[model samples]
Target: MGAAQETRTFVVWDYLVFAGMLLSSAAIGLYYACRRTGPQTQKDFLMGGQKMTAVPVALSLTSSFMSAITILGIPTEIYRFGAIFTMYGFSYVIMVVVTSEVFLPVFYKLGITSTYEYLELRFNRFIRLCGTFLFILQTILYIGVVIYAPALALNQATGFNLWGTIIATGVICTFYSSMGGFKAVVWIHVFQVGIKIAGFLSVIIQGTVVQGGITNILNDSYHGGRLNFWDFNPNPLQRYTFWTIIIGGSITWLTIYGINPAQVQRYNACKNRFQAKLSLYINLIGCWAILTFTTLCGLVLYSRYHDCDPWTAKKISAPDQLMPYLVMDILQDFPGLPGLFVACVYSATLSTVSASVNALAAVTISDIVRPYCPSLSEKTLYWLCKVTSWLFGAICIGMAAVASLMGALLQMVLTIFGVIGGPLLGLFSLGILVPFANSVGAFVGLTTGFAIALWVGIGAQLYPPLPERSLALSLNTDGCNLTSFHLKGNWTTTKGTFSPNAFQDHSAERTALMDNWYSLSFLYFSTVGMLVTIFVGIIVSLLTGGRKQSIDGRFLLTKEDFLSNFDYFKKENHISNQQLDMIEDGEAKTSELSQPITLSTQSV
Candidate 1:
């Protein structure tokens, strides 16, 4: 066993910290469940009565966006691939603007529950059901990785039983989320996000202080090529370029903010459109802060063990284990600190899983169950919502148990997002932006996108090439006085490398379409899928006798949505009256052709 496993133990104070986390979450749930004003109806329970302020909702949105996979996986990413992942923070600005200006107004103004409902309005029931099915698949895959990530990390840090931790966290999150509904989920999120930030900052501070200082950490990481950020390569097969992280990542975030039920639910929970918009900006800031802190944690971990590569030396079993190992290494002597770190991981898991459960429940109730059982009472619908939430939560737990074989949590989550999320995002984009896209086009486009995404996602995983990394900083124990930091006598750095046969494989065909497609960087999955869907959707719609009448201008974010905001530019440019009238007339045609297809109008 490695030192990490040999020395792993949890103290009473650590358990107490974890207990406090669980109890407080349950207490909040119980409190909300008891309030007569709270969760009395389906809308109240699912939508938080539509009275939430910007701050709590913003925090909740932030927590949901950055799950345990991020908390654990990002640091590992930085440690392994350098700080290129940090570029994702830049995409938040694009996400906020697109969502607020384009998507939020549409969802908020329309007063819809499930965002997929908009699909039905713009297209047909087939498209709506397709969108909802994609969302369910995306959330289930994501939440499983989210729950399993921290549990796996905690097991590494404290020697806790992995299955027990997964069950405990999943059951606790499900109970609170089901009982208390959105309000309970939001408040608990606020609390957990606070702990998460504090826990991360503490790690960075302690790690930096111990590693001489921030300057020393940066210098060491810089020398090791771990500070690498810019990659101008336009090749789609190459990972972590500026374009992929920014452009591709923007599409990824748009999927989360624009159409995701978890986020759209928060948008509706707010007091009005303005507050909903405000929460997005707040969430953007939160994303920036968390990414910066975790990036620093990665740098500091590299600095502390500059000469001692954990994975190469077998000091840590996996890259995902890096953060947990770093915490135990640095804070294990300080009794409660290790527990606090474990609690931080759990906090991330709970917030993400709870949010997903709530969102999944909302989608299942609104999109699937209600459509089939129109005669059910609102009260009965509310009970059904809880049952569905619990059911999905249980399924998520089962998925998590199976996630151990999925490799690294972060890569797995992102790949899932690319495969499943892209299609759903394409469906929404088709509805909101393309006025000519019909339901048949959307259904065909979405199916094609999903097929391509899954093929590449699974194929690349099965044939994963050895990931290229720079280990320019060689290992030594000059900074270590502790004997445990030394490599085992039996361990040989050149054990595998010494054999010439290790490099003998040459079966790959570089020119094959399958090879080229599968070789495309994981970051490009969503972007490629989205573009393919849009292109296919447009072609199919036009080829199959597209909409003769314009879609309702309200359903789509046409020029009218932003024309008013850009009045100064239009006026300064001296735009002609004929041009403006043509734009206005087109907008009017949309309103003439479009009709609302809300839940009230549709059969249950």
Candidate 2:
């Protein structure tokens, strides 16, 4: 009991270290997320004026991917499950390809202010709202989980109160998000990404040195039955086979690259079609490199501490805490390592939290509010953003608590997002792929893809894994498998020999199978969603007599139904500029000119 408690304990300095870093991050992020700038229009908040350079974009990719759960949860995966989980790094290939071929071109072409507007343009208002609602809801879950993970880590390590951690993090994130908007979010993303990778790579090297050498670590992992790389089994239930990789891998990439809120927000930030493509291409290398680096840490953990026996030690009830625990285990001898790790995790959270709040602010203000409150002013919109950011922050913290109590971290992550993301992707795909599919047909296809994904995802979760599988999938829902080495403590850690499990024990429960054939791969989820949407959309169009929207080539905007709204900002700008010019020139202005009023500023 004493040893177990000691293993999970923390120091006062650890608490202070974590708190100080977080406070600094919040201050910096707030400074960036909400700073006042030129025009202060809705487009600036929603898409950062589509003028972001590759540096911030690259960091944004890093920050978005390496959240608390990802930082800690992924290493835990490698510790318990072996090589299958490491395959996640390869997903960048799919991301780059899909972003290039499918999503970026359309989003850049449309110039959409609300990514969801395409849903309305392609399908109808219901599907558009549904898609937007799901994006917001799932993003909340994602942010919440991302928020909860580092807090959980700190709580376990230093005995900081969990609720305190939650609220503290939430309040600070809200402060920055309410102030800086997208520009702040993007700059902080750059900072967070740099710190996170430096911290991550440092541990990979240190952990390797601490556990004997890299060679010893490799030997232990290989000898412990964790080094196998192939699962040639043909069964669909075999979670990590080559076929699952091809089919499921494709789907995972599609949702993230094509439709997920995090990626879409970034995609819409590109200044041009080529830049969007270039950013994704840059993101691909970074994605693959970061994932591979993190995955290697997993392998290294498997090699060195195979003796510690994470499950038997009961350091955590689930695999999510493995990485944090592993860090603490090593940090027992080293000062500042844990602090650095915590800082890195916080960095990852910063990227996601700020991005999420900004995205929600944009969507709520642009899609839902703009449609209704057509007369909203910039001053009113900014205040609305403050209120909206605070509200979303509260909701996300609650969702994070729920995620902490439920299934495997990965499973919880996917289940919360999968049922809806596919359809959202499809709806967007329909607008781009099928020019003739009108609003009504798009709406139908969106619903159909969602329903199909839900049914399929549920089924995959409940299905059992075959005895020996091949490849690890990118799909959600606790995808990894753990095979314990020390059943009754028979295997000698010194000699590195192990006994096999009894094959006759077929009656015993073997695997935790959940429904949702992991479409975590890059192409499958979006591809299927797209195929279903295009097919259903065309059919619905034929049935309902829908037609191509008539607009001139010059009026065609990638992200917005800009033909109408283009006239609005342009017209308003012309009038406002003319009015300002006359006032500066000391000439009498016409009665038609609206007054130039100062925008009120409030500190959150």
Best by lDDT: 1
Q: What does candidate 2's lDDT look like per residue over 1-604, in tens digits?
A: 2121233345566556666667776777566554555566655665675677555676676677667767776666566556665555455576567666666544544466567765554445666677788788768867877777667655554455767877777777777766676666777777677778777877888888887787887787777666655655555545455555555555555666676656777856754444555667777777776777777788776765565555445434345555666677676556566777777877677667777877787787766886678688976876787688888878887887665544455544555455566676666666666566676787788778777766655444443223343233221212122322211211123111111111124454543432225323222444455567668978997688766455222222333323332233235446465555553343422223422211111210
What are the clashing pairs of model 1? 371-604, 372-604
Off by over 4 Å in 1: 1-6, 469-515, 563-604
Candidate 1's residue-wise lDDT over 1-604, tens digit each?
2333235467899889878888998999988888855337788889986778788999999988768888788887787678887888789889898888888867865667789878877887778788888899889888877877677666655678778989999999999999999999999999998788878977998898888888999999999788888877777666677888898889887888888989999977775555677888999999999899889988987887767666666655566777887887787677787778888888888998999999999998888887778798889988988999899989999998566667567767778888888877887888788888987788889989888888887776755532342222244544343425422122233121111113323476534544467667777788877888888988899888776756766687756445452232135335456544533433222112222235453422
Q: Compute each candidate's TM-score over C-alphas.
A: 0.88, 0.78
Clash totals for all models, in order?
A: 2, 57
Error of 1 at 7 (Å): 2.0
